[model samples]
Target: MSAPPFIHLRLHSEYSVTEGIVRLQDAVARAVSYRMPALALTDLSNLFGLVKFYSYARNNGIKPLLGSDVTIANEADPDRPYRLVLLCRSLQGYRQLCDLLSRAYLAPRVRGRAEITRRMLREVGVDGLIALSGAGAGDIGEALLQGNRVQAASRARFWEALFAGAFYLEVQRYGQAQQELLVSETAALAAEMDLPLVATHPVQFLERGDFKAHEARVCIAEGYMLGDPRRPRPYTEEQYFKSGEEMAELFADLPAALENSVEIARRCNLQITLGKSYLPDFPTPAGVTLADFLRQEARVGLERRLQQLFPDEPARARQRAPYDERLQLETDTIIQMGFPGYFLIVADFINWAKRNGCPVGPGRGSGAGSVVAYALGITDLDPLRYALLFERFLNPERVSMPDFDIDFCQDNRWRVIEYVRQKYGAAAVSQIVTFGTMSSRAVLRDVGRVLDLPYNFCDQISKLIPVEANRPLSLAKAIAAEPQLKARIDEEEEVRELFDLAARLEDLTRNVGMHAGGVLIAPGKLTDFCPVYSADGGGSVVSQFDKDDVEKIGLVKFDFLGLRNLT
Candidate 1:
């Protein structure tokens, strides 16, 4: 195939914690619009978007260059992390990249950022990897700008030897004065060191028109004013998805830099397998099969429950036979659907909680509708006695894993979690992550605060937005529905700017947070399927994917909720 003039190799999707503004769907659409064959996602320091990016790119017949802009510990100033660009050249590179990511995040906490030391690169092993001298903010470029050409050259040679055949000098033309200096000095350094030059357009948003909203997002993250000159602007409006011809002219004299982006695109081919369940194996008794073991325990529990509920033989005859029939039918459906192990695991944990004297909730959610749960002692509610429909729990029409919402005494929940952690292995358990988005109401308040408007003024205007506990109105919808909101926007220029900008900013994620009780028990180490990060840089590890995403990848979520009323 003929070489395309350029391809975007440095991009920050929405997953890049607070700075990037490009949505995954919109990024794919822009690639299609340009008729470009490939694009890359280097979201901050994590591959949080890798699975979605790879699948979407391959499905749309576009190649995805998988990589990240890693924040490595600075040798000179350990507190300040130095940015470095690393891309995967093959599946082996992806694995090594994952290894590096896990170690850095799991390391002891740092005040500002998570990072791996530059010296540790050898141990991580850059076997099937490609390295880039990152943007002017990166280690090498910063060294050059500080007039330390020797240190910059030494750093370049270090990476050149580290990545072996795959190191490239990255030159980005984003309209900075230092960029020209970086290019001139880097071109000389590249020639001397025999490194190839690759051009990358540092993309933060989808289009040029999105600059205002993107800046506002950066301000919200960094807590700066739009007019604040103390903080330097790291990007320009020119950093958008550019066409091949537009980039070709940007580097007309050094065409090899543009051509090498296409070359880098050709080297990356990542395939992510989606939708496979990774449930752990329940330890069955020495001789029994998992299905038979579950059946035996459930039957024994049923007989004990039967005797307690119906003491007289005459009552046993009336109740026992029907309860036995319901148990058998539910057990048959569970085993046939290959969920015997699922049931056994849930029972083991609930029984352990009870043995340890934790007060467990009787039943909650659709799983309460199953007689199997009652017989296994996972739920105390009797389905037949309560007349709860078994079809609602595990329908013959829809065969899926049944979820049980278990509640432990609020104080004892951790002991129960500690027991499970010890039983299943700590590496296998994690809390799920959830995103906090800038909702319609939230964006108005945030934009008002940063714009330095008065609290009463912001509140009075925001109150015009009609919202409910479950439902939220979009800014446009609010303007249409409320005459007062519409009149304020029509008459006041500040109000109009606030409304316009807030609308663009709404639905962008604000921060990462923990799901109250959605704990995922992976079959093995979670890195086998996805990445994990500490919530707020401490406490339990969280799956980068949220509850919905966790289910898609086959990690069963057990909600061990805490109830306020119980407290």
Candidate 2:
């Protein structure tokens, strides 16, 4: 293959929250249409979309460069941080990047932004990473924009020395003020310092047409009116994803900048293993394998359970035959599936919860259908008595991780979670993240507010969008269902713009949240599987990927849902 002309090195997806308008699926499709071979997703401060992006890109024959657009604390002014894009070239680089990103969220935030200090960069030691100067928004770009060549060069040298040969001075042309000057100065600095210059589009949206929607999304996020002069309008329409030909034409005067983008893409060869289980090892007695220990525990526990049901030894003997057959079959299946450790781990925590007087629910989901679960006291229900099929929980025919929805008393759920954390190693366990998107009515309200539309007018239009069974209609569906809503938009230019803007921004991720019930127990440090995030400096830590994504990456999600009635 004649070297792929150019690759996008700094594109953000919806995981960047309101700042980016590009969805992973749409971004990948756009790249394929452009005939590009590789693309990078450098979402702001997190690899929240890494696994999904990686899967989609690889499936579609595109190289996936996993990275983050991280904010680095400015030494002189911590509140004013400079943006930097760091892409992983190896698994070590990935882990280090995860550590840095996790630290940024877990540390005290500067101006509500997740940022790492210079000290953090030095301590973490960047290896197997390809660092990009954040174009016009980076430290060097900021210095160059301010006519401080010395400061710019000094900053470039620091990164160059730190990243070794993996650092590149980034140049972009988005019609932003001083961008042309930045490109020229960055090129000179690159030559003077013998550093490489790489080109990027800094893509926020998929196309130029989505610019207004992107701006409205930002306005909604920053609580600014679209017409407000004081609002920071940092992005431009030209920041959309451009074809390689377009990028080549734009940077024709400096061809190496374009070539280096391809080179960086080629160099970033990180591979992530997906769809394989990474179960944590359960502690067992010496010389006892997980399978053997599990069988021993199940048999002993079942005997105690059966003894209660059949007080007479003769009746117990008759009952024991069937129970013994069922137990052996279940144990064989569990061992065959290599889930003896998983069962042991779940039982350990559940038994602990029970012993400590924390009420756990009878059981929920398919896991209640397992005879093994009943024998081990993971569930209160007896599978055979209730005629619940073990195949529903685990089947030799269909191989997948067995999921159990476990409920604990609302007040004491944390106690059980805490126990699991300590048992499995605190760093190995974390709650999962959830993305909250802009809903239909809420999107209209936000768009209208930013558009400076009247309150009752916006409220009336929003009210016209109906809700059914607590699920609001999508913006498109709402417009179709309510003819009045469509008519109002058709009649008034302001209403048209409001609905137009709202429609585009609808269903875009607006905020991050922790999953209420889902928690992950990794085989090692959680970062080895996925990055962790904390809203507060040092409270609850959550996996950056949500429940579904975490499961795709092979970290089993254990539901520890809280129930008030169970209290």
Candidate 3:
């Protein structure tokens, strides 16, 4: 297909956490339907949705431009920082972008927001990146709005010098106050500096009607009523996904700006390697390969376990034959799959936990079916006695990464994590980050509160929704299951509006969190594989990507879950 006249250079997916409502699948499908040849996902400061976005775009024959809408520290007033959109033009730019983002999160945050400084940007170097002045939120635009053309000009010069020929003055026409002024000033500055102009629509939702739902979502996050005069309204309904023709018409006066969006898409070509495992290298004894060391350790461990099971010599001999066969079969499959190091790494940590006086639970999950795990003491269950098939754990027919859910005494789980961090460099180890989404019942309560409804009334309506095992049923299912909920929706106009808005906002991310047990150990620096961020309230360093995305980018995840009963 021929390239569309204009492409989106700035977009925020649902992975933008609470601020965006565009799902990656929906975004890519829309792009394909519009016949756009390429699209960019510049989620706010995080690359959490990048791998999935890239995969979806590629599978749909759309080029994926990887970028981030990052906040740079404004030295004059640290609390109010400036934003810039950085797009990767090559693999090296991707790596640099990851490093910069990791450092931003690692540094001391201002008011709980991660930011990088001008010096940090230069130190990291922008070798293969395209910079877009963040339009109204950018430093230049902010300065111009304040009637300080000198500061805006100075900021523009610095960025132009830093990004060289790759910097573009971004312009947007969203129906916001002073937007026309910013646009005219930006165009003039671009002309004065001889910089290219690029048009972008800061997409937060998929359609125009999603604006109110997005507003309700923001109110829920900020603890404010939707109608409260004090509440901030930074977003507009016009920020939905627009076709290339709409964008071209929006910037018709300066056609070059629209053309530059497609030009930037052509420049950014980031190819991600997926579906491969990158395991941390386990140190083996001198003159012994990883496979040999694993075999030696498993054999010795099995002999010790066998003695505990069978004291009589004749009984031991009779029981040993099948155990030996199972161990050899499992070991060969593990080695063939190039996962000896993975098993060895898991065994080392579990053994360390045991030796350090921390109570460890016998293995859980499909990994409990492995004879090798039993031999290595990674699991206490005897697969042979239970007649568990090793194939259930690691099937030679269907190759996949083996995951063992290890439980430790809740109080001592952090000790195991620290031990792993020391054994593997700290830069190589990080906790996985998880996103808390708005559930059906919670969304209903939130929408009601934001709408200034009576507290007891909202609570009454919410309680009618069915819950199973402490998890609230989906609104559709709950409404079907409960006649009271259906009656309220059908009888009350306010109730119906609340339900309709809640349905649209439900399942979108509401907050960030750390996964209880999932931790990643990369082969080298974790930043080399993916960016890392400090969790909320200044907690441990966490991977920006969650559990599934980490594996998709080739990082192996190990679970070190804590169980109070194990204590």
Candidate 4:
């Protein structure tokens, strides 16, 4: 039995949030392991993991397919629920796809759910693109299942006309009996309409055995008791990545469907590149360069600050030694580092906040070590007076972003954010996202609940595990450090099983929340650089990447942190 020639067109990576078990690198490695030359990653909707996927796949000798699973409203009936899968075949197609997805989310009425209209797709659908009549949840499949084959065929024709030769009837065999019937009907319909057929298993994990862990993840996402009979369980355990051979066996009766997967993979040639940072031009007053403007502001600001601090000093003494030579050197270093605009932009916001009667902190972090920042009103603390080194803040020894951790009064933080949105178009500014992982304690409790263990018993076992807030303790580390925990795990089979499952699920992203104060301001719409997501029920827009990932993509993240101490 030779391996079946097939490539997975609908695969989810870890960026699919809790529902996806395969990491991007792991997914690419799995494709290479299986000898599949190409693979597609259609994670939910956002392309947050595209760069990682593209780079990893290319470096490891595998072709990367850029695709998205986008939700759109039905044309005739606006309330109908369904989504379409679109894949890019060229750079232009990828850009158009991005534009469509962006509009789907940015539209005023497209709140809560990301959705586009069929009309919008018709307008934006370009050449060299492929459309997969989605699996069970797709518009055509739903209509077919609802005894509306005519409507289903009609919808298929609509897409067929829009996508021309780039459309295929998608078939999946996840052990669902309805899927078998749907596949047969879909094949017959395709034969009648002269459309191509493609096979995909809708992979969510690396292998079959991972289903249990994936199920637990699903339970975590739904906030459901794992053992609760009423909770909705996955229709099949076969959602794992099936090798080409497995897919061939599954679709043995329809070899073309299996072969079409390879054909589709060959057709998709989109490659994502991490472009240069698009930092907005900080608006300087007319007739002055940003550097000159910043210097002028700093000079005047320094004199005003000195006057306030030493009002009793004679005018002659003030004029004799007005500017600190060391401070001027620090300013030169800042300007030379190409951060004058960054400094000016930050200072502009802080000044705007202060002028509006919003309380601002003196300063936070190593940014307090810059007299240049002090003079520019980016920081209020005089570094010379505090005996702070400018090198510690800017690090001229090694080029790096000069981060000023600014604090604002809690009551007026949003006003400052609004000012930024107004100053730099609303599309240019956004907050950063942070993922909450299942910590050691959280995993223990969740696993215990799933196993139906007594709460007090689980609490006792958990209490034995020491709490380390900043530094998390692994099970092995805990066992080595705590005698009681090691003894219990060795003594009881159930306790051991609980520990086993907890250990597996621990440190996985459990939920997403907004960063306390980190905001990423881009020169263009944020989606062009990185995907944006809503944060913490606050309606605050956030980048999908954390602070580190944002910097990796070459975007400067400003921490407009709120401090309660100011209150």
- Among all candidates shown, the one with the greatest TM-score: 2
- Writing each residue's lDDT as its tens digit, candidate 4 over 147-210 gives 7889888989988888889989888889876877898888888898899988887888877877
lDDT of each: 0.81, 0.89, 0.90, 0.79
Write the residue-wise lDDT of candidate 2 on 1-567 in tens digits: 453489999888889986998989999998888889999999999998999899999999989999999998987977678888999999999999998988888898787877888888888889878899997778999899899999998999889889999999999888988777888988999999899999888999987999999998888878899899888888999989898889888999999999999999989999998888889878889999999999999999998888877899998888778778889999999999989999998899999999999999999888988878998999988777888888888998899998888999999999999999988898899998999999999999989998898999889888999898998899888888988988888998998888888888888889989999998999888887788998887598999998878988889888899999999
Give the distance in Å from residue 563's predicted Cα in candidate 1 to where it truly belongs. 1.2
Per-candidate TM equals 0.93, 0.97, 0.96, 0.87
Q: Candidate 3, residues 496-544: lDDT per residue as tens digits?
A: 9999999988887778789999999999899888999886523588898
The per-candidate count of clashes, in order, stands at 0, 0, 0, 0
The residue-level lDDT of candidate 3 at 239 comes to 92
Q: How far is candidate 1 from the true structure (C-alpha RMSD, Å)?
A: 2.4
TM-score ranking from best candidate downward: 2, 3, 1, 4
Model 1, span 164-186: residue lDDT tens: 88888888898877778888877
* Clash pairs for candidate 2: none
List residue ranges in candidate 4 displaced over 4 A: 1-4, 51-61, 74-80, 90-113, 119-129, 146-148, 253-255, 273-275, 303-328, 395-397, 469-472, 535-538
**After superposition, candidate 2 runs with Cα above 4 Å error:** 1-4
State candidate 1's TM-score.
Answer: 0.93
